[model samples]
Target: MANHELLKLTANQVKKGNYNKAILAIGSCEAHGLHLPEGTDTLVSYKLSCMVADRVDGLLVLPPVTVGYSGHYDTFPFTITLAYDTVIQVIYDILESVLRNGINRIFLMNGHDGNIAPIEIAARKIKEKYPDARIAALPQWWVTAGELLPPDTFEVWNGLGHGGEGETSIVYYLFPEWCEKELATCVVPDHLPDKIEIKWDFAELTNTGNTGDATKATVEKGEKMTKVLVDCVVDAIKKLDAVNWDYSSTNAASKL
Candidate 1:
């Protein structure tokens, strides 16, 4: 059926009321480093979204949200970010659209750290509006972060920012030609000493505006990370209990 996500659904998949669940990629279009393109965030998020959608038959896939909240990355030249409120609106709008389509379950596939807040907000709001809806917003990395990379590469200090080894690794695996192999340097950000704030306009902290080492990133590691994370999300969905205690369908529908 041409990959669930890419499939141009016929009226048949539409009328069976066959839609049971869906995976939405909440990504961002912004700069990473000199080497990586601005859409790295959206790219990884989309991969995770598709991975989850491919599993568990009744799930439909939605296009990735290419623009998301990224306030922390505005200092960079090509970095693009939406205000906190605007991003919240985007998420809210998308969730409503999916809920209207008889989709009771939603998995928010997140790739950007900055997207954490708005995603959380949207999750909560989705629940409030549609009491029967089951929505989970989980960052793509949080699930398989441990299993994907070596313990030594964790780099607890500088990971809070953008365009780091973690992100680069994912991109490298998906698109090796686009990655710069030598960008991941050992030098930690200056803010490591302060230990208060690691990312943002604190230009003095970063020697290269990169939090972690992108040069150390490898396609192998990224591939492993992607698999781990994707598998984790699919596992979580399967493990979930069916419609907790209450059996009611709110027949409300929304349009995109």
Candidate 2:
């Protein structure tokens, strides 16, 4: 059976039950090297949320927030971003509106790295206002695809990077036709001196705007990685629903 998606349901159907948990997928519209599409983050994150919704009962997947805080990629064409404050306000407002409908359990699945700080800030502020509500936000990259996959599965890149091996592999598995593997190449930034903090741009990193060895990506690895990712998300949702502890007495009562 197909999972329930908020955008696909009617108002009457949505109001007929006590569905308290919801998923809000957040991603970005920005450059992803030469082979991957600009919509890579949004596509992968939204799809992953949908997969989780199908497995976990009473979970409704919200339409994804495709545009995120990506000012660092302004040099690239067709990239869009929201101001930090704007993103935070948007998240807070969305959560408030969701609360109005009695859906207090929110899993914020973020696919963009740049939106982490704003999302965390918004989550904290929301908890301060709505103690009973639970909001959890995490970047999908933190899943550690390398560790999840078999030890000998990959040869070049072992971690997630911008349009790198991990991201490219997943994209290929999900939408092979959309992936331009022929153009995929390896490009990483030079090693930096320890403790040398500096502001840098994608242009300064590599000539192709890529940050990892995309040439090593394969569809088989992507499939395995995606399976583990889905399991992780399903486990998170289950754990969130299983919590029975009361947060009524604590200032940090909001459970992610």
Candidate number achieving the greatest TM-score relative to the actual structure: 2
Lowest-scoring 10 consecutive residues by lDDT in candidate 1?
153-162
Off by over 4 Å in 1: 6-17, 140-144, 147-161, 182-187, 193-199, 202-204, 241-256
Worst 10 residues of 2 by lDDT: 244-253
Per residue, candidate 1 scores C-alpha lDDT tens digits across 99-152 of: 887777887888777788888887788889888888876764643475454676
Stretches of model 2 off by over 4 angstroms after superposition: 193-198, 245-256
- Each candidate's lDDT (Cα)? 0.70, 0.81
- Candidate 2 C-alpha error for residue 187, in Å: 0.4
In order of appearance, the predictions have TM-scores of 0.81, 0.89
Cα deviation at 60, candidate 2, in Å, is: 0.6
Residue 116, candidate 1: how far off, in angstroms? 0.7
- Candidate 2 residue pairs in backbone clash: none
lDDT of 1 at 228: 75
Position 209, candidate 1: lDDT: 48
For 1-256, candidate 2 gives per-residue lDDT tens digits of: 7647888888887776446789898899988887988988889888888988889888888988888898888777778999999999888888888988888889888888878888888888988999988877556553466777777777764645688888889899987888788999888666745569557777777777667889988898788878988888788778767764233454766678
